[model samples]
Target: MAAIVWQTPANPPEPEDYIFFKGKRYVRPYYFEFISHVKNRWAGKTIVDLFTEEFRGRPYEYYESAVKSGRIQVDDKIVSVSYIVRSTQKISHFVHRHEPPVLAGNVSILHSEPDVITVCKPASIPVHPCGQYRKNTIVGILQAEHGVAPLFPIHRLDRLVSGLLIFARNAGKAEQFRQQVTRPYCYYKSDDVI
Candidate 1:
């Protein structure tokens, strides 16, 4: 009869595992700028815009405190929750403190990126913070999930509605989107593109 031998493990501890509903598992090595893609892809938008289009369900309120703690990022750096995202930059999420970010209580993630995130917000979800929805809106869910850059709801969808709604990654892009929205489509092309 022959004797058997045993082996020992090498690595130490591993990171904690948690399930994310909206996080993009596909880490594509892509770059974007708030300028170039903003005008075309997600130009001129706010959290409310999406409500009208995707969640005409109802109205909601937003406070600075709730927005202040919201998470955001540009190039791996967690920035102002509401800071606008510039053109052609890498983006993602971080830990969010923005009052847990609200949701329509019913929605799903379609596509997400540094510059823009398309959501299928349901009609029951409010676009912004308000009522029991201070932490039940789509933005809230997103903020809670990754804690990236503060998000701006460019357009809205009805609470009961459903479709593609885009969100801005930072404040610069939010304001730029607002400005571009007021002007003609050919007015700006963004000085920054990566």
Candidate 2:
């Protein structure tokens, strides 16, 4: 005879947001979670099928848009609406909670060319939205404060560190930087050992 292992659902994130700028500690809301009890429940089923048939209530269109916007994740990784599940897996839905921090000082835009834009990002401002950060990110700041939109970031810097960052205005401009720019830069801290 085989033994069965009991399992419990994941604890939902609290109403208050948790964040860690440098270390790996952050908490974000989980709108909902679904753990397949049966191994074959998701076999040969599309991502939308599981949401519509199993977790039905709202229209299928809702789930479709949610998946498209990266609100759905299969086994901790965001997946598309057309993704297929082969076996029992955990699905998590994340909801964006708009609780961004406010910074009084203005971010400096070093340069703004037709193809790219360079800005001096402040410390504690995230380059993009993730975990507990949303409207407080560099991209968000540019839109709300400087009125720059549809900017594609070429590279990223740590949220806890302030430095110059570059962003490409379009995909073609991004490719140009990737092909033409080839310079080696070193980042080292003198503590004790290399």
Candidate 3:
């Protein structure tokens, strides 16, 4: 197994992560490369069909246009949309991503330890990548701001909820924490209920 590396914030958040305007937070549009490998189940399927079936984020016409424009590639080379995929073949999709604006709240670190880190998650930002949010999330902000990577969230908070969140530094710690939290009588209390 590979050794896990723990990172902490060493610099400020990246300028490209967001733009603060009129008290609103908006993430700047950026390009992202979505890379994947063909699985055994996908073998013999057309590239366009595979994309259309597996990824519903874009329309079939968009995938066709991307394939033709070389925005989508197979094994580092552009291929036709009708090209048949083979097992273990590499596929790349380069897309321009735009995340929606979120609340101009900060994700503040509350505590840190060798195996765990705690933070005060702000509202309007998802804990991780979901739906249309990829970069405008707590994980993304922590990575861009603090340089922490490969984080394993022990629990999650809703996008509209603000509260303390815990993250494990490594997979083992995450699993251990999960086991503890999943035990019977391991309950949570909200401040509002107090």
Candidate 4:
């Protein structure tokens, strides 16, 4: 596990806000994370249009600046407004959380029992083993940090989306959680509170 830490402003930021970190200490506020959040969530807009709308302080100058500065790269190349922003696509200027296979502090223990562990996973963390996020996911944190190895997540969450995630402490209970999760309302059927 690599040594990872976060630094933030004197005032805490709401979830979805961005802050720059220097080791375990916060350096300063970087930029507004709400730009991506707003652009990504809106419907029926072209990528360029979304970009222009989100970064409201400038005109063509801003887009030109982002392109010229090499701050925005897509598909390993500097992208123009023509690039389509699809689901799960990595945006330029996006701060990717790429902590190595270690216990990321992003997870919160929502519920824990002998059978399972439920967590309120932040938007930036991965849910399970995939891509560069395998061991930095919710299951990894539960097993490695919380002293529960062999943990399995009941469902998967997108890397940049916030939601509840469940991990199985044992195989049997894992399957039960799996069954309930697939049934939609089964989360309510079995756990009541989730």
Every model: Cα RMSD to truth: 19.4, 15.2, 8.3, 12.1
The digit string of per-residue lDDT tens for model 2 on 88-185 reads 67776654344545343456999999888999987877887665565567776676567687678788898888899999989898887766666555
State the TM-score for model 3. 0.83
**Residue range 1-194, candidate 4, lDDT tens digits:** 96433322222323333233442212122331112322346444445566677767557666656655655554445666565565545454533344343322456788888787788887666776554443455655555456556677677878778888777878888788778767655245565656
State the displacement of the C-alpha of residue 88, model 4, in Å, after optimal TM-score superposition.
35
| lDDT of model 4 at position 128 | 68
Judged by lDDT, which candidate is best? 3
Q: Report lDDT per candidate.
A: 0.45, 0.67, 0.84, 0.55
Candidate 1 C-alpha RMSD relative to the actual structure: 19.4
Give the better candidate number (2 or 4) by TM-score: 2
Candidate 3 lDDT over 1-194, as tens digits, reads 96532222232346476888876688877666677899999999999999998999789998899999998999999998889999999998877777789988888989988889999998889998887787788988888878777689999999999999999989999999999999876355774432
Tell me how many clashing residue pairs each candidate has. Answer: 65, 0, 1, 4
For residue 5, model 2's alpha carbon misses the true position, in angstroms, by 42
lDDT of 2: 0.67
**12, model 2: CA deviation in Å?**
28
**Candidate rank order under lDDT:** 3, 2, 4, 1
On TM-score, the candidate that comes out on top is 3
Off by over 4 Å in 3: 1-15, 185-194
